[model samples]
Target: MEQIVQAECCGKTITISTGKIAKQASGAVMIKSGDTMVLVTAVAMKTAKEGQGFFPLTVNYQEKAYAGGRIPGSFFKREGRPSDNETLTCRLIDRPIRPLFPEGFLNDTQVMATVVSADKDNDPAILSMIGASAALMVSDCPFAGPIAGVKVGRVDGKFVANPTAEELEKSDLEIVIAASQEAILMVEGSAAEVSEDDLLEAIFFGHAAVQPILAAQLELAKKVGNPKRDIPAPVVNEALKARVAALAKEGMKQAVRIKTKVERHLAIDAIRDEAIAALVPEFEGSEKEVKGFIEDLEYDLVREHIIKDGERIDGRDTKTIRAIATEVGLLPRAHGSALFTRGETQSIVAATLGTSVDEQRIDSLYGDSRKKFMLHYNFPPYSVGETSFRLAPGRREIGHGMLAERALQQVLPKHDDFPYTIRIVSDITESNGSSSMATVCGGALSMMDAGIPIKAPVAGIAMGLIKEGDDFAILSDILGDEDHLGDMDFKVAGTAEGVTALQMDIKIGGVTREIMAAALAQAKDGRIHILGEMAKSIAAPRADLSAFAPRITTI
Candidate 1:
């Protein structure tokens, strides 16, 4: 049986049809808005790879240049590798659905989301997530889904569900959230610094509004879902687990007792190296696997101790932030510069105010677009205490930069309020964790240093979660290792009164509301603490732009 469902989203009619396209795929769907359409397909490999512990699911989101009646910009005039935007969109599609799959089903799976057509006013990221979920539900992939996503915006403190591109121009919040029928799976966006309560309200509203879409997917799945394939559960050797656990126990205990970020990391690395060497004699055939398992176990133990025992790796309480230092006008020649360091993560954010002529004009499938504010994030090799090639910003850097950009967009002065085209560059000098949030803090201070007179000061904090069965701990201002080992990364940005932006990603099955509430509460405490540190250096934006920066006059 084939089915098609239609509804109004962001003032446009959105239609979804399954069993009509890519019929051979386990599950497939076509989503359309006006003439712009997207075909999403999902397929899982017949067999799981032996000894492959990680889920081998891959998501590819492609934007055809021809979709918008344009040729590729490159000299080849053909699409090649995925652009940064496309890669991030693929990641967005991957994050929400990946967790919804059943654990232990490690079959090779692929989800392809292609924008066959695109309307200039509608963004394809949220729709792609929707299509991906629809396809998985209808496929034999064993997805615990019927998940749906929406882009929420804020204008004059009112929340708008699935706002169009034009509406986003006037909105302070550009939030994308993916949710199952019961809980949110993924959230990423930028906000102006909205209150904590408002942020939670927006999440609830988005969840409620997307429920109908989830219902539609479930209905389609019932009609066309394929018979799920059987895959063996991932096996863990009992002996290997026990041996490695013993090796890491004491070292992990010492690592967690340290007080500073750098010191703790050094101790952990030494412990891991020693454990790997000691385990080589016990497991000759699977030495590599044994070491990897040990490291993961060490992380798990650290997180459990933090949550259950009320202890952190860096010895901070659950609500405590790392030490913070702020300095303005750090660079003599820069228009406006500020260096903000929270624990070991440091960002030197510089602001360059320009006239309307300096605004960036971007040509894309959506057509010509002008952006008045641009935020660029750079991560050099030395930032992480490593040495590597000096190339262009990779997808991670670009994605992180964009996240920070969105976080700060909520508080930027409007064209009517201040006519300058603002560009902020965050140079990460050191990174242990959450450089993007540091970019937000530093960008705010830099704009103030440059005298942009922004509406309000914005701050951001990264929250981490460690879950063991029913026991869970929410850590505010988590370190890099905690992020890697934790189950969830929840970032919130906002003003003292409300939230401006929120983004959440989970590694395991979607988190319950109880965990989300805890994360939000912890984030607020960390955000306020960070804002207090920022206030000590500068309380508000300056009254005049830097002489070096271009001046713009509004009519």
Candidate 2:
């Protein structure tokens, strides 16, 4: 028997169905919104790969031009490589689900989410995750899923779930969160210097709204779910583990105690090298086993410190933000600019106002799209105090920039209200903690410095967690060292009234609501403090934009 359910998120009705299409796959579902529809299919190989240790799960998100009643623009007249936006959507779909799969299931699995229709106003990323989860729940694949995703925006200090693209433009905070029934799985967003408390509240708002979506998937699963497949678990050698632990115990402790990111990483590398060299003589045939032992030992040391002492490697309190400093109009030539520093991280953000022609044109399978607000993040070798040959922004840079862009999106004026293309560039001059959040803070100041009539100023802060067994410590405005040794990275951005953007990534297992709640509460205090410091530099936006910036009059 097939099941279909529909619910409203933001202003759109999301309909999900399973057991009616692609029945041959382990699990499959069709999701629809307005005239736009997407088909998500999940398939897992019966047998695990010989050497593949990680869960071989792949997520593909494709947007067909025909979905929007448009044809391809290229001479070939067909889709080519995935666009940057599509790649990002795929990442979004993958991150939340990848962590939720049951441990020890190493089967080669694939989750494909294809958009057959698009309304332009409603993004397909969140919908795709819903469909993917539904498909997985009903499939024979062994997945610990039933996750749902939603986009939260802040408008006039109120939180809106699944906000429309139009509403987001006017909001000061834009956050996307994916959650399971009990805990949040992933978060990604940008903010306009909202309070930490508001950000936490918004996350709860999103999580609560997503509960219905998860219920819908479960309902469908119970109706047509296939029997889950059985797979054998990987084994660890007790003898080899004991030897490796004895050799690496002392070195791993020292590695976790190092405060600076560079120093800690260097210490870890040296320890691993020494361990490998020592093992080459004792265990000539078990080099791989020896290497794995060293890694696990290092992780154990870091996790134990957090769980036992409630202390971070850099020695910070759970609710403390790093040292922060703000400087506005740092560059004379730029229309508006601000250099924001948090702990060791620093971002020089500049705002440029352009005419309509200056707007960015995005070409994708959907069609040609123009964006009035743009945020670009650049990471140079100097930021990390290292040297690299790569010249252009890599995937990480693009992804970070997009995250910050979404955070501040909620505060941007409506197109009709302020008709100018606003571009924000965040040049990472130094990085030790959260550069993207710094970008959000600097971007807000830069926009105001340029005299853009933003609804409010937005700020962002990165939160970290060190967990071992049941013991854990949540750190606010974390430094790079804490991030590296931490198990969870929970970032929240927003204003005094509500949250705008949030993103969380967990390395071990998922967290509980209690932990998430505590983290949010601490984050609120840090966010408010950061905002107070920013106000000292510039309280509100200037009345007029810089003379050098282009002026646009809406017709």
Candidate 3:
């Protein structure tokens, strides 16, 4: 039987149907808005592979050339590797849904969204996100979601849901929000220096807009949903856990307060080795389980210290930002260069100027276009004090670079005013946490050093959260360890006047409006403090471009 559900969203009708196509998939749905259509499917292995230590979920979002009535222009006459747009969209769809899976379920799962048709007025990325959740809801896989996504824009002081491309052009704020019926799950987008209040309102508006879509998914699932598989409970050896905790309690307490990343890690490792060696014979063939128990004890201890004692691993308060230092013109031969260091993290960013001929030409479903600005981020193994075969840029690097790029995009001069093509390369020499934010600060300083007439300087900061039932604490400028054990990782970037870009992901179900408001307030203070420190080096754009830059003249 075919099931279809329709909802009116922002005066436009959205249609979602199942059982008519991709019948062999575990679960599949076809979603359409305007003339744009996306087919989303979810499939998972029935059993976990042996020795699988982590959940293996992969998401792919692909755009077909024929969707927009175009042919492939490559030599092979076929679509090639995933483009930057596709990769970014994949991350957009993955972040919110990844956490909704039930713990202890280690099956190899994959979700794919393909754009089957395209229209001039509608964007398929948002539609793809909705379809993903709907597909997962009806599938047999164990999922804690039936979430939905919406794009919010403010045009002429009015909030618009799922705004068209033309409306977005006239809008000052653009944000994509994903949420469950109860609270917001993920947020990612850029704005034109919107205030904290305005941004918070936009988020709530988006949350309300997605309610109808969520209802439609539930209705569809009621009609044709399959029985979900049961997730097995993880086994716990109480005796072993008690033994490990007793031996390592004192050592773990002191280890977390070592104040340095390298020293702290070393101390923890020593404790782990001693415990494992001492208990290997008694708890035969369960070294991994013993290791897990020790880690859990450490996690609980650290969270207790922060919540009850109001102390962090580095002895800072919940709202204190780390020390910052900045320098410009570090590379003489380069067009412009800056070194930005915050606490233990650092980025060396360089900017280069080029002519129109150097603009990156992108071939897409909508046709060809050129980009005047590009930001590239690189993370070598040595940054974390490890060694491995250095490869090309991976998904992490691309994602971080695009985030920093969006943060700076709000302040760039118009193409007509500054015709030179600009490129920024951010090399992270050291990283403990918030390396992407370091890139944001360095990129801004580098561009200004190159004499590019940007509208304003930009800075970024990453925030974390630790919640225990009714008690919760929002942290500012979190370190690497806090991010690992916390419940949320939220990043905010912008100038002193307002926020330009925001990204958030949470490990819990979702966050309340009150929590989000507090996090945003704390994040704004941290961002402003970072900007003040950045201003000590260079406050404005240089008086002239580098002598090596190409001179531009109207033809």
How many clashing pairs per prediction, in order?
Answer: 16, 22, 0
User: Rank order by TM-score, top first?
Assistant: 3, 1, 2
Give the TM-scores of the predictions, in the order they appear: 0.90, 0.83, 0.98
lDDT of 3 by residue, 322-366 (tens): 999999999998899999999899999999999989999999999
Tell how far residue 90 is off in model 1, in angstroms.
Answer: 2.1
Model 3 stretches with alpha carbons more than 4 Å out: none
Note the Cα lDDT for every prediction shown.
0.82, 0.81, 0.93
Displacement of residue 285 (Cα, Å) in model 1 is 0.8
Q: Which digits, one per residue and each the tens of the lDDT, describe model 1 over residues 1-555?
A: 678877665466777898767888877889987777899999888777887767898999999988898888777988888866898898889888887777788788999998988876667877898999988887888888888888888777788998867778788667788888778889887665555666677777888888778877777777664666665666778887787777777767777678676777788778777876887766777666776776776676787778778878777877889999999989877789999999999999999878888998865787677889999999998888788876588777888888878777777766887787889999999998889899989999998999887777888899998888888888899888889888888888777766766778988767777788778888887888888999999998777666777665556
- Best lDDT goes to which candidate? 3
How much is 80 displaced in model 3, in angstroms? 1.5
Q: Model 1 Cα displacement at 78 (Å)?
A: 4.3
